[model samples]
Structures are given as structure tokens and as C-alpha cells.
Target: MSDLSGSERRKLEKLLGMGSGYVLNFSDRTFGDFFDEYRVEIDNEQYKTGGTSKANRMRTFWTVANNHVLGRVIEGLIEYANEEQCFGDSNPSLVTNCQNIAKRLLSDQPVAELDALTAISDDYDFEIVANHVREAIDKNQPEAALDRLHTFVNKLVRITCERYNIEITVDKPLNSVFGEYVKKLREDGHLESAMTDRILRTSISVLEAFNDVRNNKSLAHDNPILNYEESLLIFNHVAASIRFIKKLEASIKTKSATALDKTKDTKNDDFIPF
Candidate 1:
């Protein structure tokens, strides 16, 4: 269940046009489609009964959804309202109020880091694994996501290696692939700070141990899972490393593009008429 206070919930209900029997500017079909985009089944019998209004359905959703899903749904509604011009001169503060509520609801979620992983790649396999991790995290069950997170990291590292022309085999474990990527970054002069380099080296061992956790202590097998706090800690650690790599790769692309532009300019200069 979400942690929204009663006043906050009422504010959201009013801003979303749910104070009446409606929700935002969505029709019945469009409402279902909107929820479906986030994998939320709002039409389930559990959320619907005899003459249950759309407002009530949304209220039910808020009552049962975890913070992560609740935050996403709220943000979706805000975006939809903006697109539909639901907030006209009649209610000038509607958008700001909605945004403030969303910020409070999502304040402690690790949504940005999770989003960063998918931003790094659009591979079908990567998205599938990323979604599983997201579902687990949304349901507040990080332990169940451990195996999927490992697979996601492996895919990310392999993609990074391929992008940089670093040799990697499928059989190589996550730590090995990641270690090689780190070594390449250092060799290519991308590792500018001693502290950053040390962190990457530490992540190598962390991912090495993660293999064992995925195999033995995770949902990958019939063994007891790690406790929630430690699982969350591991998730945060791995996510931070992924965010760092994402920035590093982005910087490399920018530099390569700049160099290519310079080369083109040089060629253009040489082609000028005498």
C-alpha cells in the first residue's frame, strides 16, 4: 500500500478529476489503455464491482499499489492532463499541485537508476530482464529480483564491451566482463579520477560475489534469499555503477562525434578554391 496521506490523496483525486465519477480526460477505453501501458490491470474484478465509478477504481488502485507503481500512475496522469490541456485558466495551479504530490510520492524511490538501465539499451532481451527487475522492485521484493538483476548487468556489460570492441565470450561471468570493461576504460584514459577507478575495481568483486548470491541465495534456486536490507544495498551499489558507466559511454560518444566533426571541417577547408 502507498504512503499517501489522506489530504494528499484528496488533492490528487481532485486534480485528476476523480472527485467526480471521472479520471483525467480519459474515456473508459483510453483509461484502460493508459493503465495497460504500465502493466496495471485496472479492470480486474477486484478493482471493479457493481456500478463502481472510475474514481472509485482509481482510489482502489491507490489503496493497494506500492509506492513505485503509485508514483508512476500519478506521473502518467499529470502528463496526460498536461497534454489534454485539462488545466486551463480556471485552475492555474493544477499542474503545479499535481507535480508537487508526485514529487512527494516518489521521493525515496530508486526509479531514476532503474530507468537508467533501460536508457542504456533497447535490446529485447535487455528490456525483458529489466522489466522483471522493475516488477520485483515495484512490489518491494528486491530479493526476488536479484537473479534478473544479475542477468541485466551481464547483458549491460556485454553491450558495453561490444561497443568498445572489447573481446568477451558468453561464458564469461558478470565480474569478468565488467572487469574487462573497467580495464579498457582505464587504458583509454576514461578513468580520470583515482576514486572513480577504485570504485570500479571494487564493483568487480561485488559483481563476482553477486554471482554466488544469484546462484545460491536468490530465487534462482531453492535456497533462502538474502534479507531485504542487504538486497536493497546490493541493488543500490550495482545501480550506481551502471549509472557511472552510462555517463562514461555518453562522454565517449560526444568526444568521438566532436573529433569526427573536426576531421570533416579540416577536409572542407582543404577543398576551398584557390
Candidate 2:
């Protein structure tokens, strides 16, 4: 042990403490034999007095320490096994799994937020767009993810147009869809709250900037590769927008339904159709 390098001594100490039992038995002796030739030569005459009792006390201390150390080592080994592939850059599943585990352990946020955003209207188109975005993020393809966000905005606009019975061609630009849908939402009084309107307007500006980035700098066009920061920014913006829009749309539909129910009641004359 004295002759061994510092790291090697530490490794041996760890290995020695990893076994079970309160005393060094046949198994422990067998392990020590691996370094038999390298054991430091002892000058026994210098400390012969009371050496046997000291050695016995040292052995007792080590036995207790070994039991404690082995328990911790087992725990560490299990933890490492669970996260072995998590830091591997190539394994998306491992990364996601590790994130989920850590998130579960550390967070008190609503579990619903971790779930995929639910569409307030027909979900087929929304799901398709969301899946594309999810895959792009999982694969670390930030540019593709940003492009998917742009695509999602287009889909959302189209869905809004359909909801309002507004005619729009498939070839219409994103700006046109945004302008028309927002105009209709405003005119119909569905977007009544000043704060809500501000959020929507601001989000539209973000969407426009996102569109430009996708077209001019993201992988959607001939440009530089998207870095983690840029991609994460786009992802957060896109995800926030999707969650807000879906919740808002769902609330409006609920309001509309409630209003319609009131209209059917002859006693309620002030019911307004949405």
C-alpha cells in the first residue's frame, strides 16, 4: 500500500471496502494477494511494543468502515447504472429518460405540462406538427425544430381561419394568415382583454421573427447550423405560444357553448352568439 501511487491506493481502498463482512476472511485475503509482491517491506523492530493490540484495533475499525462504505458503493453503482447512457450525446432516449427522472425528482410543477399540448379543436393536424417538432428536438436537430415551429404557426393560423369560416388558399403566406385570423378574432370580440390582445400581438411578432430565422439562418434554408441556445430559445417560444393558443381557443369554445346554451333558454334574452 505504501509503494502504490496515490490514485492506485485510493482505488484499492475503495475495492477493499466494497466487499461484505465484518472481518477480513478468505475472500479478502485472496483479493489482497493480487498485490502480494508489491506490499511495502516492513521494519518490524521499530514498533514491536504493543503492535499486536494496535493492529487488532485497526482491523476492528476497518471492518466497521467497510460495512458503511460498501452500502454507499452499492447505491452509487445503481445510480450510475441508471444514468450510464444519459450523458452520451448520441442516445436521445437515454437523455430524455434521464431528464424525465430528474424532473420528476426535482419538480413540483403540474405533470400535465410535461405532456404534449392538447389541441382544442381537431387534433390530427396539431399532432402531426407537434410530432415533427418533438422528433427534431429529440434528435438535436435545432434548425429542423425551428422550421417545425414555423410550420406549426401556419397550421394554427389555418385552423383559426377554418374555425371562423374564413376562406384561405393553401398557398397563402404566414403573414396573411396571421393578419386575417387576428383581425377576425379581434372583430368578433373573442380577444377582448387588453392583456390577452397584447400577448397575442407580441407572440405574432415572435412568430414572424422565428419565420425569418428559419428561412434565413436555420437548417430550413441554406445557412449556418443552429446552436443549442438559439434552438432552445425557439423551442421555448414555440412551445409557450402553442400552449397559450390552445388554452385560449379551448376557453373561447367553452364560452361559446355556454352562451349557446343560454340562448336556448327562453328566460335569457341577453345571450350573445359568438
Candidate 3:
């Protein structure tokens, strides 16, 4: 029997302690092979340690510690697998560490970048996006506001789909979700018919674009950059589609003004109908 590696022994101890009354067994040579790689990183002897944390000294030690711990977590999982170590002892704990990393990664936040977060708060939270929409509405720029809203909704849908690795070319499902969001705004009085035409037009465009993508057809016949690009075709389209909100508001204001004018004219004509 050869000697056991440090991480291998660490994993064994963890499994034995966690499994407690349960049966536990693993070969030492296999365990050593499992941890051979990460154990090197634990010592920082491989000359590769951290990514974002090491690059920027501003990152807190806690963040650095979290990432450094991941090296062991990786080693632990490897050892667990090699030893056929049942009981789910090491994995569940190590997975928690991986889950934490995944959660933070999704934030699109870098510990070194403070100013970057202000612009990208929306990338993480829709509530932040909603607050921005509220400000645009308060500014009486509902058209500009809806355009922003459309962009937000479209991106939300696309991201959700892409994260699942579904076909991005087939966007109707995503559009369908945003359509519901738009209808919600309409029901809440955030949108009206003057806007409906434009919304419908955009919806049709999205549907059309989706068809084009699915059928290998296109109006422009060439892909655009961002919203106008070869990629992000739908994202860019949704962003551009909100321009009709202005016309919706304008049409309403015009109709109301005309109605008021007609009433004043009748009063001046002495049309009391007596």
C-alpha cells in the first residue's frame, strides 16, 4: 500500500466523518491520482491560482479565499468519484461551493470593477430595469420609455432561452413571453392602441424575423451587428420596435385636443337644442 495524498486523505476523512455509520472505502492509489492536479494548485506551485481576483488587488480577501477553496473542492469531487465514494458526503458540500461560484458568476459582477456595476445593474435584476423605465415615464418620454421597455423584455427573453442552449434562430417562444409582458403593460395602462399598432407591428416583425430565421429567409438578406447585426438580430429588432409608443401618445393628445375644440365651437354657435 502506497502513501495517501493530502487531498485524498482529506476527502476520505470527510466521507468517513459524514457517512458516520455508513460503509465507506476507497483505494489510496486511485485517490492520489484523483487529487494530483488540484493539490498542486492548493500550493500555488502550478503558477496558476486565480482569475479576476488575482488580476485586481482591489478584490477582497474573502472573494480570493472563496476561489482558492474551489481548488480543493475540485480535488475533493475528483477523489470522491475515483474512490466510488458513496454517501454523497463530499460532493454535496463541495457542490455548495460550486453553486456559490455559479451564482456570483451570473451576476456579471467583477470584484475589481465598481463603476461597471452602475451601468449593468439591469443585467442582474429586472427591478432595476423597471426603475429605469419608471424614470423614463416620469420624464414624459413614454415613447422612448417603451423603446427601452421593449429592449429590456427582448433581452430578458433571449437570455433565458440562450442560457438553456435552445435554438436562438427560433425566437417565437421568447417573443411570446415578451408579448405577454407587453400585454401586461397595456392592461396596466402603460400602453394603449396608438401604441398597439406599433406594438403589433413589432410583434409581427419578431414573428416574421423568427420565420425568416427558421425558414432560412430574411428581409434584409444580410445579418446585422447587435440589433442591426448578423447576430443579435432579434435583440436589436426588439430594441428598435418601441418607436411606435410616441405615435400612440401623440395620436391620443391630438384627438383629445380636437374634441375640446369641437365642443367650444358648438357653444359659440348657440346650439343649445332648446
Highest-scoring model, lDDT? 1
Can you write out model 2's per-residue Cα lDDT over 1-274, one digit (the tens) per residue? 0122344323323332322321122233432342232221112333233243323322332332222222332233234434543223335554344334333322322122323333435678777876776655444344556776677767766776788877789776776676677777788888769887877777767766776787887767778757756776667666676676677777999999998887778555666677
TM-score for each predicted model, relative to the true structure: 0.64, 0.54, 0.23
- All candidates' lDDT scores? 0.81, 0.52, 0.42
Quick one: RMSD of model 1?
A: 8.7
lDDT of 1 at 229: 72
Tens digits of per-residue lDDT for model 1 on 143-207?
87899998888888888889877788767788888888889889989888999999899989998
Better of 2 and 3 by TM-score: 2
lDDT of 2: 0.52
Which sections of candidate 1 miss by over 4 Å? 1-103, 110-112, 272-274
Per-residue error (Å), model 3, residue 68 = 36
For model 2, which pairs clash? none
Predicted structure 2, TM vs. truth: 0.54
Candidate 3: residue 129 lDDT (0-100): 60
